[model samples]
Target: MRTIEEIKGRCFITEDGHWLWKGALRPDGRANIYAPDYTRWQGDMRTQCGTRAVWHCMHRKPVPEGYRVFGTCTEKACCNPAHVRCASEEDFGLWMRKNGNYKGKTNRILANRAIGRKRSVFTQESIAYIQTSDKTGRALARELGVSEASVSKARRGDIVVFAGAAGGMFSGLIQRGAA
Candidate 1:
């Protein structure tokens, strides 16, 4: 088991009182630590976030159940106990909503549409046409200005919006589970 002093030694305190971790970082750029005996049941090393490990070492207790530890400072790699805080999922969500940083479903959809990342080329009329038209998938796709896969899906009633359109060509097949 590594001592607290050894773990503390791996961090360099900044003038702003941030303990910048000089250890491995997770893919999200957060600090990670490999503790050999963090859990006794496994008797093996475990990778833990640096801030959580530092909070455990300083407080001599694990973070409260149903709570997650996060850094409060601007430095993503800081592991200072004073800069770490624990919050339940609900509390964190409330805080995010209060700060207007919560990206809920409506917000995500709006953002995606604003960036032109999610625009539906298939409208109700196009879907109806795709279902009724006897043209090949490629031809239908070319006529509709969409991909062949999209045309195929529309023909097979796989597209959600157009699948239930009344009097569509594939409506009978869709009802019979044949499409």
Candidate 2:
């Protein structure tokens, strides 16, 4: 395994031969350390995707062998190496499930249901009606089979505006505002 300090400083070489100074290949075969990019902030070694290695020092795990940390340069262009953990292709499926990282029904339907099962929270038509009309919280709650509190919360912008424009009613509610 590569020493933590070595992984932390090493740079990744991209296929085009450009030096991606973000991540490094650990000697342990399990890590790809991504170096922090030059940034305006001091000691900011986080990745563009909102990940950081704060956990590494906290977890104190050694970098694995034969692993290469590549710069994801995700849309955000972050260089946080802690986001670069690895898994064998054979264990990828298990990893996703265990980490609650998959887009299955558990994340879609069941999770939505847990939030109240109101179709309005997930539909544009419902949002338009709520935003474009003078529907009361009670009325919306009745229509959507959710609690009046849910309707109020949505209207107040305390939650996502899934109702879209119908969600506009939230402004009125906020203007008149009820918690």
Candidate 3:
């Protein structure tokens, strides 16, 4: 295992306080470190990843089981302890969702569903007919940019706000007895 002294000698601190490796870098732009004595570390097999090695060298402790170090700064090669957190991948995903870091397209759609931020693809007249129209759920969903389940829920009256447009007047169907 390379001693903390050796690792520190190969790295420099950034203006932001990150310990960046000056050695070889991986294709992903992450630091790469390898040592002949690395096998001596029972704690994560003396990681070849520069960031992980930096954490181990600084903390002088093994990473807790069921957790991996994540870069809070979004830098894969950042070795600053302050920028790293130890958490299960699942927990990290939950944190991402809560912290608005979950920007995946599907997740964005889910966020839209939760907050009613999804734009209404149906007009007032379209909403009025969603319930009585003989169109299939798939067609309605595609036309409305919603899931087939949403179309079904709207038809069942489970979604009172069936759509949003021209103000919150989506429930206009109820006033007109369109249901």
In model 2, what lDDT does residue 65 have?
42
Q: Distance (Å) between predicted and true CA of 158, model 1?
A: 26
lDDT of each candidate versus the true structure: 0.69, 0.44, 0.65
Residue-level lDDT tens digits of model 2 in 1-179:
12334543444545543323354434432234333422322334543222224234333443344432233333222324444444444465566556665456544544544455344454545555656659888888888887888667666655543332332323435544465
The regions of model 2 sitting more than 4 angstroms off are 1-121, 161-179
Candidate 2 structure, TM-score to reference: 0.24
Cα lDDT over the full model 1: 0.69
TM agreement with the true structure for every prediction? 0.50, 0.24, 0.48
Report the C-alpha lDDT of model 1 over 20-116, residue by residue, as the tens digit: 8888899888888765433332324567877776666665555666887777766888877778887997887776567565456665545554444
4: Cα error in model 2, Å: 38
What are the root-mean-square deviations of the candidates from the true structure over C-alphas? 13.3, 15.3, 11.0
Error of 3 at 63 (Å): 3.0
Error of 3 at 53 (Å): 1.6
Indicate which candidate wins on TM-score. Answer: 1
State the weakest 10-residue window (summed lDDT) of model 3: 162-171
